[model samples]
Target: MPGQENMTDVTVIRGNVYERLSHVIDPEIGRSVTDLGMIVAIDVAPSHSTEGVRAPGRFDVTVHVELTVPGCPLTQTIQDRIDEAVASYPGLELVPHIEVGAMDADKLTGLVSSLKAERRENPFNKPGIKTRIFAIASGKGGVGKSSVSANLAATFSALGYDTAAIDADIYGFSLPGLFGVHSQPTNLNGMLMPVTAWGVKLISIGMFAGADRAILWRGPRLQRSLEQFLSDVWWGQPDVLLLDLAPGTGDMAISVAQALPNAELVVVTTPQPSASDVAVRSGLVALQVPLKVRGVVENMSYFDHAGERLRIFGEGGGTRVSDRLTDALGYDVPLLASLPLEPDIREVGESGRPAVLDSDGSLADTPLASSFTALARRLIG
Candidate 1:
């Protein structure tokens, strides 16, 4: 009779249970279960005892859950969250009976439609929005533009600022690998979720595969892909969005300028004249578009050897690019940082983590991290 008693008690307290479940958020979507229409129904019933009678102080609380997708990778996480939510009810002895199922086509379609409608256009381009967009560009390949982008993004996230990144280098995408993200973005209806790694939300063409990559790669190669990355993926209004642009002074920069009018340009160049010369040209793309040249980052400026800073790639490339961009853009395009060439940057990056961040995704207290932290602060400030 304990089951009957507990069941009877839960029936009266089911409203309170619903309220508690409302606080349980769907981690992937960042929305509460109730808000996402995940909690379809709850049935409170008595547990049968061996004697064919209701067990005393025992109840089977069956929670009907309609997930957005069947076989979702995060399904167990959601279920665990729901179990925790149910167990949190004070002074109640209840066994959770979670019945998981996918949302019906019509309901899923409606939910996606509602979310899309609420989002409207790209949140970054909206007036008074707070996201700071920085497209990291280089004139030539091998200037460490992607490295700078990945590290800067990790630094931002480590500093407690919400950050996101895009591997806008469609042909030479690298963020996914740098961030060690092998998982694909979750597709909620037609909308794609950005994969979160290194405490930063990220999306890249590299995260897509076969038909998915083809679907996302639809439309004109350059602009449309950038636009889709902007318009299609759910970025959630990150405080900073970094784009590791393709190494060139061409279409990607123009596409970024058009898609994200508020985006600033952060040109990445080596300390060598050859790299800096092209780096300057890359920043010059701002002149062609209405984009602001934020600053210049001089990577591989030096190699530290026994307290001596060795300028392996030659010096002053950052300054030259900064000076050129300032004059051409008529703005204060300062040289933000001169990051030393470190082998660990490549080694750790190859291992699928940003060099600026420790294993815990926090900024390591090394010189490299400090440099990136300062760079991030300067850009934000």
Candidate 2:
């Protein structure tokens, strides 16, 4: 009777474990373990006591997982998800044992081929794709365009959006350092997986180093790099995508318009007239291209010292950009937010963390975070 009961339990638990694992997603691929063919097998057996008797409602679940690659940085994350799925089975004590291995050459090849086929060419260009693309640009350098891109991407992720960012500023790539991402993206065959940092999926030329970086820079045309980033990387249809464009009103913006017709431009400016004057031109590129000029963000608008707000960089730069773009484009391009000049934005950011977020990766409870949250909501709307 005991043996018969144990057999019944094993069958039920195995089925349940398999079902639960279907909900556990592989972080990089953004697909369930079962769907990705990673779950080679699920073996469930009753737990035996020291006396060699079956322990009621207790079982050991051994999950055989074949990862796409060996020594994956996310291997531990996937294992933890599996462990949580098994251990949380209702009304029973399930101990999880995960045996991980890399997929065989043939199997890995097949998987990569299938994924590539499904994601033919640039995924964002497909009609009916639900990704919101925002290209952050500035008229010139030193306007904090990259900083805005990095922090805004982090805010979107913290607010529970499936967010991705690109350091479209090829030669001036800064998102990698801002987000504190050090490792290169995991290359699966020919496809690349954007490194996840501060909850945002990110790809940048800065992530590559030495020969790899040189190889990317070998091509004469700058647009080729943007094209490769769009097609070569597997993006999995993010809800919001941000691009930190290279400072100036040139090739990158046009490339984005051609590659992503639905992209909206967000111009960044400082409180100074010189920066804002050029920033307006950055948004005016929308006239030449089909891209929409979403709005303007004035960074370093002021400094909050004690109870008084000091206009450190002068004032009305955001307004100047917004009004000029609105008049030139014949659309309502409002000044989204006037961000304060804070030292933390620089200090924390240089330390490889977005200032809007805490060390734990959640949005920090600060005025800057609030401004970003509001800015994110407006952009999405």
Candidate 3:
């Protein structure tokens, strides 16, 4: 009688197993393996009644998983998640047996085709999309615009926002080096997957090799590069998108405004007067386009030494920029933050990590980290 009930339970579990596994998403594709036709077969049978092998009425679930390609980088991770899902089935003792294989050429092609058809156009361009786009700009180079973009992206991700960044500084891209992403993106058909590092999805020209770079860099114009990044890649509608724009107030800013009409500008400047003057001009570009000037960030504003806050780069450059922009644009542009000029900022950044974030991708407790966290919150709010 007990064995008969166990059989009924197993019958119900067959459908339940597939439902449970549907939640396991492939990190690269951002879709469930079950939806992608990766789970080829799931055979469920009664476990042997042998002593000490498994509890009575237990079932052995053998799951056949077919990957999109052989030698996939995340093969082990996918296998482990499948095992956990089966082994921890609720109210039953389920022993999981997973078989891994690659999808046949025809099946793989069909899957890729289905995805491309479903996502034919840029998801962000659609109406009523809730993604907040931030364009980091500076009037001139050496004002630490890229550093602010990188750290701000890291901070947004660490705070649990789905974040993505574009190294729009195409001619002088540095996000690949800053994020330390040496590996190439996974190319599924013509759509490329962004490399996730420090919890932020990133795409940069530096990540591509000779031929691959050339294909993406077709047309050799600033606006074209930004268009390719937006349309060609599978961005999956991130909650926050940050762009590290090229310095000196012209083509790139106009391109971003034209492309992303809702984008807000965040100006970065130093405490020095030379940098502040240029920085104000950078934010003033908002007047020409429909872009909103969000706020200003002052980098290299001070140096902390032996319990003393030293104004190494002079003071009030951030306020000056913000005040000038407010008067010119007739809108109050506030000074969001003033970051310190610590040696670790450069050293850690060069080592391929955002200094405001810890090694484990959490916000650090230092002043710099706090500054970024606050700035991110204010910008989003």
Q: How do the predictions measure up, each by TM-score?
A: 0.87, 0.96, 0.91
Candidate 2 wrong stretches, greater than 4 Å: 211-220
- State the lDDT of candidate 2 residue by residue for 1-381, as single tens digits: 757967887888899899999999999889999988999999988889999987878888999999999999999999999999999999999999999999998998999899999999899989899999999999999988888998999999999999999999887788888999899999999899999998899999888866235333433377888999999998998999999998887777888888888998999999999999888888888889899998999999999888999998999999999998889999899999999887888999999999999899988999999999999999998
Output the lDDT of residue 96, model 2. Answer: 98
TM-score-wise, the better of 2 and 3 is 2
Clashing pairs in 1: 1-56, 2-55, 2-56, 2-57, 2-58, 3-55, 3-56
Q: Which candidate has the highest lDDT of all?
A: 2
Clash pairs for candidate 3 = none
The lDDT for every candidate, in the order shown, is 0.86, 0.91, 0.86
**Candidate 3 ranges beyond 4 A from true positions:** 1-7, 49-57, 211-220
- lDDT tens digits, residues 1-381, model 3? 756976777778888999999998887777888999999889888887656454565889999999988887778889888888888898888999999999888988898788767766666667888899999999999988899999999999999998999998876788988898888877766777889899889998778775234333323376777887887787876899999998977677888888898888999999989999988889888888999998999999898899898998899999999999999999889999888887867899999999998888788989899888989999999
In terms of lDDT, model 2 sits at: 0.91
lDDT of 1 at 85: 81
